[model samples]
Target: MKNESIQPPRFSSALDPIPDYLTHYFERTAGPFLNICDLDDEEVQKIREFELSNDIKWSRFKMWPEFMKSRKAADDLLMRLYEEKFQKSPAHRPVFAVLGDFHEIPCLYANPGSVRIEIADLREDEVTFMYPDHAHLIQFFDHDAPAFGVPLPENYSEERMPCWGKLFTYQDLHEIHVEYGIKKAIERCLNTPGSFVFSYVEAHIWTRDLKFTPIDHEPTGKCKKA
Candidate 1:
């Protein structure tokens, strides 16, 4: 008797659709940066086409541009919130902190203080932890890591290869849906005065036998021992 092949589930099941609130947030909060970078033309067109094909506005399609603008604003707003909330925290000082016993591997072909560009080589069994302030720490397993590319003056690349694996966060991951307005919600989250500690652990596994697991916590306080 022949054995039947098992197929993996669809991507939709693996990843939930972006909530309407987040969609609105993305449109309003991140829209400006996107507009400045000219990243919304194609997305806007797609939404329009979808609305026309479905023949249902329910709300209104005219607000698409406004939503996009709001989305871009959110990114900048989030950064400001992060800085304000944690800049004075003790954990925010060192950009990279190594846990356990490991040697600090200096870049072979690059300078320390010079413009260093790190790419998350998904191909390698390495994981990177990133903070809102552009700080990153890398943890590698018993594998040959890839080389880094030289930094370019103009037209730099922000492509990062995050370790292909599951990551767990300590903070509440809220998904919001908005039908019409999200400006107030965005403002509330962005401007509200409070501090939060976020933490995460990620497992980067190339295979069942070859894998690297490193845990990271946000807010720094979460990592403290009781």
Candidate 2:
């Protein structure tokens, strides 16, 4: 008997008949998403030195500020990139989300509530997608691992490579879908193992206070609350 080829997972596209929603995960008790950069240095330092019984998936990232001046600098870079692509400043700091159901993300809290926002609800111009997370692409942010865009193995096709170190607007994604079909375009960002693992397309929502529905708590058993 012949063995069947296993197909990779399929995700909804922004242009699909039934499109995917962007998911923002957070500690339900925290209320709304808070930008740490907005906090004073003293409070930020406390978080940086926060004690936890056990290490979490992104525990090391808490030390990231040691490599940079501050978290504000990082957000400035993000805003600069956003303005470079959109030619305008965002009204508020973006609320981050993943393109679809991507539970493998290492940065998620131990027990989190998710807010799902429909793609249709967001303006195409206000949403941007970044492959393998934007921080990995920051020139100054030391990845502390292999650089992105490391050549793939001999058998891997070049077309599978994502637009590394860049952001993609909704129209850009649409153009890619037109050329390669939505499945391949989605493949370009999803499950791509490079210097970083568990990679998923990150969506940055430029507009603030868009309506979203809260979902059930997701317990990943990855870490304890710090």
Candidate 3:
């Protein structure tokens, strides 16, 4: 019996590319390589004050405190995990990207754009990290990870975690693919429509600087038409 009442996931598409590379999506206006935690306390306070004065309801200003806490907790855990694995600390607030081509990730932003970067593009000295899904949200809220969307497979283990409980390096990309490749990651999201969690595998690029394409903003939002 066909259950047409169960609407399919909105973002997954037959045309979504299963690319050989990764992509960093951002607001073209802001350009790429920006991290919110980079802001100093005073600067953040100024923005918070400004936003509250302007009467913006549920603004990022109001959420800054808890968000920062979550972000820092995740970042600290990532640093510890990476250092333990690689014998050195990775740079704080590395640029965020996702393995393969995922259209839904970019749509989370107000003005989305992407620049594709591949493993070959990285310098030999550069270090990178990856997780099967968004690192911060998953790592910080691990208690809710396994049951995020559909119930996880009965055999789910650390080797098959769907979120940030695990971290991988560029050297581990091949092994990662064998464990949870692009196709599987996409399918996980597709299985649960109307939920953005576990949408794609996240790749954290660590470098002092990076080269990126110019502003290529595509106006889209989950709540509004593109």
Candidate 4:
């Protein structure tokens, strides 16, 4: 008999064509793509509510209070994410956001200052240069990066992250299925870096049994940020 322990096939995307809006986001945005894995609109909404109810300003991050407050909120779905993953998450880590056009519904965000990174080479400073953090902004505007994350400024304000951009999302699909599209998007994002590969985060709803198929196709590149 053949080996009994062989695993079943990984998820594929032949059936799930990449939605138009999702592709458009990548094409329109200049930066290398950043996929915020395993979050849903309801939870994202709760996080936004948490931001407002607690007065979580851009520069303000007393994690303890935010933690306590989120814990107290009645939204179990939101706390399920926060209590475990985001409990110790510094405000510096950009918060995911939902935005849209007359076209798209749910776009991801990296709160302007939440993503900090080294930019000394990009600038001319004897000391290190960090934007989005030091400048109190994320520099998401007019970006052409293949992919990079800017840390939120230590003194950032919510006002700095402008709402308009080229972000698009697939609100139509169930959240679990969206993972497939995101994985494909990630593959496209890393392709340029050539040898670089990043971990594909398991979706919050992921389980061992109900897996989706991985799409085997190369990116279409139909979406352009301009």
Candidate 5:
């Protein structure tokens, strides 16, 4: 995994070496179980197929300014489809959504009155719909932690390794899903060793937002950004 010549599996233009810090985190924590993703892997195919099946269009945008105009366009279509097509009220709608990109991070959408139709806003870069009850969700958000694909600092603590590369809402951890022993798992990751953690923060949009570019449809020896 330390080969300097080892490129990032043809989906990204990143020539950066896979950091030793990431390797250490992987070794120290239950990194594989944390469910981080590689774009050029089979795990991503599910979301890709979902997008194609739904005819969700893809575009390249990373800035709010760049995405705003089209965000409304996508929003209009998605809102109409969701509200008029599959209209579900807050209680009837899902408690959370599992955004299926290369990574599978969950998110909270419905509240007292409205369900989030803005979800279609991410269709290009992320796809899929996974309905989660309060029983199966947890969230964390540490501003100090690194975002996905960003390198970790030298001398990073193994204790905080599980906190890296994920989003935190800081709400669901306390606000919702008080049962099903989700906190027990969260504590295991933050307190003990070799633990797996999940988050409900929409880390995907906040981390990359309009800046996220889709990787190639299939893994290859060369980069083919979508």
Candidate 6:
């Protein structure tokens, strides 16, 4: 039988702008680091109330907590492994290895004192890298269009851009990973030297699906089943 999947809807520059309050809430409550350590019942309840009051679907905001926890746990476990097995201090290492195998990258061992390793939570379609003073949020979107395919007026760049893809459902993200092999691909990227940071690196990979779409034809219903 021929494949009959529906192509996911393309975001045009026509959608309504996301509210600033939602954006601020996400930034403050669902962080990659701070949330993991400081998230509490009260905060979660407050967010739940906000979402309900604003008519925002809870699913859109739910992943942040799980993603934050998973990433922190992974980082903690890896750090422990480094401390016990390598007997080396991560503080001494400024460069961090992400994805792939550390052995394949000669540069990794050459600067053990300067290298820290981390495995990202591929489930989280977005990652934010923050230092003591600087921060950057990297979002993953469909490869066919500009990162975050949602449509918005050009003038709405600052407001609309920040909200782009923040509305993506977890299922949408999962489909992207399945279709693109994003998780494994990122691991491979980490293994390859020069593909990622070599010193004091804070890298975020936004995995894009490689599937092709026909302009005139819509994807079959099967595609939407994912």
Worst 10 residues of 3 by lDDT: 1-10
Cα RMSD, model 1: 22.1
Query: What digit string (tens of lDDT, one per residue) describes model 6 on residues 1-226?
Result: 1233332223311111211110001122332122322447677566545543442222323324343343334344333433543355343211122222222222211111111112233333332221100111222211222121112334644343332223222333334433433344344454354443221212222222112111122322221112
Per-residue CA lDDT of model 2 for 1-226, tens digit only, reads 1133222124433345323667776644444456655667786565455523235455433534352353345456677778888788877777777776565442444335666777787787677876545554544344343333223234433365445546787667666644544444455644454323324467888887577766554344644445
Task: Highest TM-score: give the candidate number.
Answer: 2
lDDT of 4 at 17: 44
lDDT of 5 by residue, 30-83 (tens): 212122222343544543343334321121122122322333333233323234
Error of 1 at 158 (Å): 37
Q: Taking the candidates one at a time, how many backbone clashes does each contain?
A: 27, 0, 0, 23, 5, 16
The reply for model 1, stretches above 4 Å from the true place, is: 1-40, 55-65, 86-226
In the order shown, the candidates' Cα RMSDs to the true structure are 22.1, 9.1, 9.5, 20.2, 19.3, 22.5
> What is the C-alpha local distance difference test score of each model?
0.23, 0.56, 0.53, 0.24, 0.24, 0.28
Query: Model 1 shows how many backbone clashes?
Result: 27
The most accurate candidate by lDDT is 2
Q: Residue 125 of candidate 5: its Cα lDDT?
A: 22
Off by over 4 Å in 2: 1-19, 49-54, 60-71, 140-162, 177-198, 218-226
Give the higher-lDDT candidate: 3 or 6. Answer: 3
For 166-187, candidate 4 gives per-residue lDDT tens digits of: 1111232224334334444434
Given candidate 5, what's the lDDT at residue 32?
A: 20
Per-residue error for 153 in candidate 5, Å, reads 34
